[model samples]
Target: MTNDKKRWLILILLAFISALLLAITSTAISIYLYGNKTYTAKAEAAIVLGAAVWGEEPSPVFRERINHAINLYQNQQINKIIFTGGVGEPNEAAEAIIGKNYALARQVKLNDILTETESRTTYQNLKNARSVADNSKLNKFLIVSDPLHMKRAVLMARNLDMDAYPSPTPTTRYSSLRSQIEFLIRETFFYFVYLVFQI
Candidate 1:
């Protein structure tokens, strides 16, 4: 073959290999992230990860997660609900407070609701909630959130040695799709870096 033709062929082969590797990596990550299941049986508590609260109310995404946790309580799947989120802004109201109020409005008992209102991110949410649960001598619990976030939550919980299962709530269809794609891409890059450092 001509030298130029051989170089072009080599470039095409490299491109094909790169595409295949990307596809495989994406598929594996998707399966890993999407395979977590919601809690189905009784547990010590249901921990709802906080999202933004709009004017002392739960955002739509936050509301969905709170409602799902409430449903678990109503069904006796868990005895307590722990809402975790920090204050969004000065006087903006804590995400946990908003989630707690949302459940209270739905008739969840006051004492059964707990709040970890100092977590500004998912890792912190799980960390703070787990600390409270540990103090209370609770063992198993459910982590409630958007589906795309469940796997990360579960992994974090396991890393902290908590017996946690995911219980994702319904998210807005278009938003869920968009969020999933964005998270998948971002996490793929993050995980690649993580792997590089063996983290």
Candidate 2:
């Protein structure tokens, strides 16, 4: 109403906007830095998160994630591998089943392979994986994915009350700055959305 009051209101609004921007920027930086990191924490199972499966085969990204999990399994860092993804189209193999088969072919023991074949998104993946983990009396999980996807994937896992650790693939498909930043920004956005709006 008054000039001084209007000036104070404008100042407060600017400060609020500035704070939000700073928070968002800080989170983005954290996500970017953390995504590039690899964890050494051992867990009961490595959750190989799903990516595109080309018909009956895994896409490059999915293969990298599965290979990383395979290495963990071979190194005895994890006792089991839980692959998560469901059928995306008619006649398409569910990603979890395809990933399990790949690991089996690569010599991962048959008894150590598990699948959650109903998840279509990251949240659903972890959500359903948690159920499988619960049924098996397993609590700790190593979340395997592309380096750029580790943060949110771990967030979802921990949010589901699992002892979750990050195990991002060392060789990621996002090999360029443009691809890296694009994924970083995208994951950061989803991370904030999940933090603010979901458990």
Candidate 3:
């Protein structure tokens, strides 16, 4: 090809690469910033997204999320709690039930707690929780989860057309810098996937 044409082609390629990198960097920053944010508005219920259950109990990560929901309940920010998760392999107990029990032990009333033991992904969790919300005539919700997980969780909730607000757990088990970075990378990738594929 002519030198002029080759020069233009290289410039275009460089621009494209730069734009892609900038987009990714901005997205990561947005995710990080949003995760650290909290919303304290009152909602009809707080939907505690599920994480791994250790045997019959909540894993540290899951417990933080449950604890956040409990705090919301105690503060009267929400009137009900909806726990979501299906059974994880090698553990017969469902994540939702385990979360329910954890909340129950923490003094949350059984009458105010709901469980959907069929969701295995963030999308499914909110989708199933919306159905549960509908049956109970609950319209608004506070989506409770870890800080880094809030961005994706709230996105999925909004995509599901649910009136939801983010309420990330003040304390996260991913406390170390390395672990927090790892979680951020994982969340950023999933956020991209969900944005592009709506999955």
Q: Which candidate's lDDT is highest?
A: 3
Whole-model lDDT, model 3: 0.92
Listed in order, each prediction's TM-score against the native is 0.80, 0.92, 0.96
* Residue 173 alpha-carbon offset, candidate 2, angstroms: 0.6
| Residue pairs of candidate 2 with colliding backbone atoms | none
User: What does candidate 3's lDDT look like per residue over 1-199, in tens digits?
Assistant: 9999999999999999999999888988888899888887799999999999888889999999999899999999999999999999764799999999999999999999999999899999999999999999999999999888889899889888899898988888988999989998899899999999999
Off by over 4 Å in 2: 1-6
The number of the candidate with the highest TM-score is 3
Residue runs of model 1 more than 4 Å from their true location after superposition: 1-24, 27-36, 171-176, 187-199
| Model 3 misplaced regions, further than 4 Å | none
lDDT of model 3, residue 138: 98
Worst 10 residues of 3 by lDDT: 87-96
lDDT of 3 at 85: 97
Residue 128, candidate 2: alpha-carbon lDDT: 95
Query: Candidate 2 residues 1-199, lDDT tens each?
Result: 9999999999999999999999989988988788777779788999989899998889999999999999999999999999999998889999999999999999999989889999999999999999998889888888999877888888888878889989889988888999988988888889888988884
Backbone collisions counted per model: 0, 0, 0
TM-score of 3: 0.96
